[model samples]
Target: MRKFIVAFFMLAVLVSLVSCEQKESQVVDRKAEMKTSIDSLESVLKAAEGDLDEDLGLQMIDAYVGYAKEFEADTASVIYWYKAGEIAQNIPGKELYAVTYFANIFEDHPNHALAPQSVFLSGVAFDKMGDKERAAVSFEHFLEAYPSHDWAPDAQAMLQMSTDTTDLDTQVKAWLENANKTQE
Candidate 1:
């Protein structure tokens, strides 16, 4: 009876070990599946960059919008948004879209190293949209918040330009002309 009892105990221990291992394997499989999904999404976004289809590009951009929150505290995503802002601003009627990207980096990731640049780009996008008052406000906020930042000088210059002229319409016209020259 003693020998039989010892065998039973040993069998129980072996079964428990197997069960633990199976659970570990299941967890690893889940992790791999999640990684695969993220990678697939990234690949689709990258490929969409060169796609001539606006619908596909916009779809990818919308998909990336979901990942924007995931990018919180991630400096790389800040840079990515900054670049996306640059691209979106260049496309006519997309300035507001670009504003959203820049605002994400500036507001959600304020302490990020790229936050100042992100704010500056936000102002630039606003300016491109002919919203001088809002642009001035954005630039002014960046200057006051990050006075020592590398982009501070540019922001300050933009702020001065934004305020120097009394006529809003004239400033708007000049800004558009300058923007056209850059686009060309």
Candidate 2:
């Protein structure tokens, strides 16, 4: 019984090592495959002249999102996530995907170089989608977290605009007061 237990433990250890190796190999293989597909899509986009191709663009977004999600430990994942968010933001009706991808970078990789910009862009994406409340929240979070970032001013502006929603009203009030001042 003791011998059998020892042999089983040894086999289990070997299997665990083999599985880890296989998992690492799988990640590398998948990354290579994804890189090839992204390169192809980029070439197609570059050749598209002035017109944007939605289908090809979505494919590239999917590839980038897949790579980023599957390999979040990889630093390239943050960059690809940002790229995916940018592409999704430009594609009508995919704004939510843009917010998610951008959020992924800031939330999952907060210390990464792109995190601040990604968070700010997430706010922009939400604003573009007309979800002003969520956009304000995102912007506020970005500003609070990255007060010294270069994009902080942009984020602050967006946060104010999104939170206030009364620029036109205020402008009209000023214009009406200015016109009435002529009567006085």
Candidate 3:
């Protein structure tokens, strides 16, 4: 009975060690894979910079977002999130992706250096998508949390502009009415 107990304990310890090793290996593998993908996409982007291939830009954004999400605790993750958000801004169809990636930096790692910029850019992304309400909310959040930031003025202006579209709306309405008058 004593010998059996000793063998069982040894087996358990060995299994635990092996499990930890496997977990570490998996982490390294995942990081390496993301790095490869990001590098490949960036290389393609550099080669086609002037023409601006929106599709490749989106792929690069996805790679950066994937890396950040998969390794949230790593410092590099926040940087990748910023990169993803910035790239998404230029891609016409990826405004929402930009907003989420930008929000993730501040929402998940508020103490990081990119947090303030991320919040500001989140508002910009929302604005670009024509989501005035959301853009105003994001700007408000930035002002509340980062009142002393250099971009505070910009955020405040954006908040006001988003909330008050009366002039533009009135002009559009008047234009439509005039068109109807002309048609009649």
Highest-TM-score candidate = 3
lDDT of 2: 0.87
Candidates in order: C-alpha RMSD to true structure: 7.3, 5.0, 7.1
Candidate 2 global TM-score = 0.76
Reference-based TM-score of each model:
0.57, 0.76, 0.80
Q: Each candidate's lDDT (Cα)?
A: 0.75, 0.87, 0.88
Candidate 3 on 79-116: residue-level lDDT in tens? 99899889888789788988888888898888788999
- Range of the 10 consecutive residues with the lowest summed lDDT in candidate 3: 44-53
- Candidate 2, which ten residues in sequence have the lowest lDDT sum? 48-57
User: Compared with the true structure, what per-residue lDDT tens digits does model 2 show for residues 1-184?
Assistant: 9999999999999999999999989878988998898888888888886356788778889889888878777878888989989889999999999988888888888998989988888889899998899999999898789899988888988987788767778968977999999889
Score residue 134 of candidate 2 by CA lDDT.
94
lDDT of 3 at 118: 91
Task: Count residue pairs with overlapping backbones in model 1.
Answer: 0
As a whole number from 0 to 100, the lDDT of residue 152 in candidate 2 is 87
lDDT of model 2, residue 69 = 76
Error of 1 at 124 (Å): 0.3
Candidate 1 lowest-lDDT run of ten? 66-75
